[model samples]
Target: MKKIENLRTDYKRDQLNESSLASCPIEQFKLWFNEVLDVIIEPTAMVLSTYSQNKGVSSRVVLLKELQQDGFIFYTNYNSLKSEQIKLNPCVSLLFFWPDFQRQIRINGLVQKISHESSVNYFKKRPRKSQISAWASSQSSVIKDRFVLEALFHDFEKKFKNKTISKPPYWGGYKVVPNSIEFWQGRESRMHDRFLYTKHQNNKWIINRLSP
Candidate 1:
C-alpha cells in the first residue's frame, strides 16, 4: 500500500451560525434536514448506537424515516439486538453524516415504542414480501442455511395469501426522543461550525455554540 503525504479537500462552502439555528432542537433539526434533503443522496441513512445490559454496545447503519416532537422514529424487530439494547437501556444516540454537504447531526435521547395502531398502519403499508418476511423470519436468530430462510419465506407467503397481514407482535417502531441535538458543518482548516440545542428539565430547548 502506498501512502500519500498530503491529501486535502477544502470545505469553504458554508457555515452554521447561532442566529440561524433555532432555540429548540426540533426546529433546528427540521431546518438542517431541509437543507441536506436535496443535495445529499440517501440523506436518511444514519448510524444508530445503543448499549445493552447484556450485550454491551453495538452500532449499525439504518434508514431513519420519521421525525416527531416525541423523537426520531425507525422500525425493526423488537427481538433484534439493537431493539433489545433499547429495552435494557433507553439512552440512545443517532449520527448522520453527509460528506458531500460537509455536515453531520448528532442526537442523544431515550427510546420508546410507538402506539400499536401506528405500528399496524406502517406494517400494512409495507410491500407484500416484507410483510411476509416480517412474519416469517425470526430477526437476529441464527439459521443453518439459505434453504431454511427460503422455506420459512415461502411458508408465510402461502399463509398470508389473500389475507390481511398484521404487524408482528415482536416487530414495530421505536422512537428516540432527543434531549440534545448537535449539528456540525465542516469549515476551512478545521475551524468548523458546531451548534447544539439542549432540552432542559422544564422542557424548554436552549441553543448554545460549541467550540469546534
Candidate 2:
C-alpha cells in the first residue's frame, strides 16, 4: 500500500479568472452548478458547518434543496444537534467541492428558519415514506439499538397508512444568507485560482482575487 503522506493529486483540471466570472456570486454559482449537472453524482450535496459555544464546531453533509436568488436552503429536524447549535448561533458556513472539476465553493453566512408555509410547501412534495421517516426519526437523539429505530419507523408507517403524511412540527428548512462567497479552481504546480465575493454595506458584491 502507498503511504498516505506520499499520496497526492496534482490538479490541473481548470482555472478560474476574474474576467470569466459573473459579477454576482449567485449567478456564478448557478453557472458552475449547471455545468456539473451531468458530471457529478449528488451534485447538490454540500458540507454544512455549524458552531456551538459549548460544543465548538461540527460539520456534516447535507443536500442543498434550493438555491434562491438570496441564499441556499436545506431542511432538517429542528431538534437535531445542528439545529440546536443554529439556535445558539446563527452564523454558519457551507462548502461544495467538485473533484471532477477540481473546484470548491465556500460560503459564510447567517442562517434562519424559512417560513413555515414554505416548509410545508416543500414537505408536501416529499415521498410518503420519507415524510413518515421524518416523523419517525427523532434526529441526533440516541436510541438503544437498530431495533428501536425500526420499531419507530414501523409504528409511524402504520399510523400514516393510506393517509397523507404531513410535515412534523419540529421539521423544517433553513436558509443561509451569505455575506462572503469564495470560488476556487485547481491549477498546475500547486497553484490555484481563487476569487472572493464580499457583500458590501450597500448590498453590492465586491470581487477580489486571492493568492493561491
Candidate 3:
C-alpha cells in the first residue's frame, strides 16, 4: 500500500475573531466571498461535499453559484449522486478554501430543495445553450461517449430554437442551512487559528475557539 503523507503550506494571511465576524454566518460568508471575487489572480472556488446513506460518500468541486439567508444553493440533476445522497440524508458539508487569502471555511448543514420559482429565475439567466443542455442531459448518468453528450446538447438546442428555454423538471437548486461554521487561518508551523460558530438550542450562533 502507498503511504499517505501530510502536505501543507503555512498560513499567515489574517486572523478571525468572534468580535469581528458578523452575527450571521451568511453575512460573514458574503464578506469573505466578495473579497475572493475581487481578486482576479488565484481566485478561490467553492467545494461542495455530499454524503449518501445508500451509496456511501461522494464530493464535487462546484462554483458558489448563489447564496441566501436559508442556505448555500447550487444546481444539479435530481437523479445525480449528490441529489440521491441529499434525498436519503439531507446533511452535507461545504468547504471553501481561498489559497490566495490563506483561509478556509468549513460549513456543516442540512440540505433542502429550493422552491420552483427560484429555480426558474436562475435558469432564465443562464446562456441559451446551457439552458438547452440542462434540459437534455441526465447529469451523472452513465453515457457512451462525448459525442453522445454533444448530440444531446445539440438536439435540445435545435428543439428549443426560437422558443425560450425553460427549466427542466429534473434540474433545480438546493440550499444547505448551516448548523456549524468553522473558519481556519494558517499560522506558523501547524499552529493554525480555528474559530467555530455552532448553532445554539435557541437558534442562535455561539463562537468557540478550537485547538488546531
lDDT order, best first, reads 2, 1, 3
Give the local distance difference test score of model 2.
0.96
What local lDDT does model 1 show for residue 117?
88
Cα deviation of 202, candidate 1, in Å: 1.3
Task: For each candidate in the order shown, give its overall lDDT on alpha carbons.
Answer: 0.87, 0.96, 0.82
| Stretches of model 1 off by over 4 angstroms after superposition | 1-7
RMSD of 1: 1.7
Query: How many clashes in each structure?
Result: 0, 0, 1
Q: Write the residue-wise lDDT of candidate 2 on 54-107 in tens digits.
A: 989999999999999999999999999999999999999999999999999999
TM-score of each: 0.93, 0.99, 0.91
In candidate 2, position 9 carries an lDDT of: 93
lDDT of the structure predicted as candidate 1: 0.87
State residue 29's C-alpha deviation in candidate 1, in Å: 1.4
Question: Which candidate comes out best when scored by lDDT?
Answer: 2
Return whichever of 1 and 3 wins on lDDT: 1
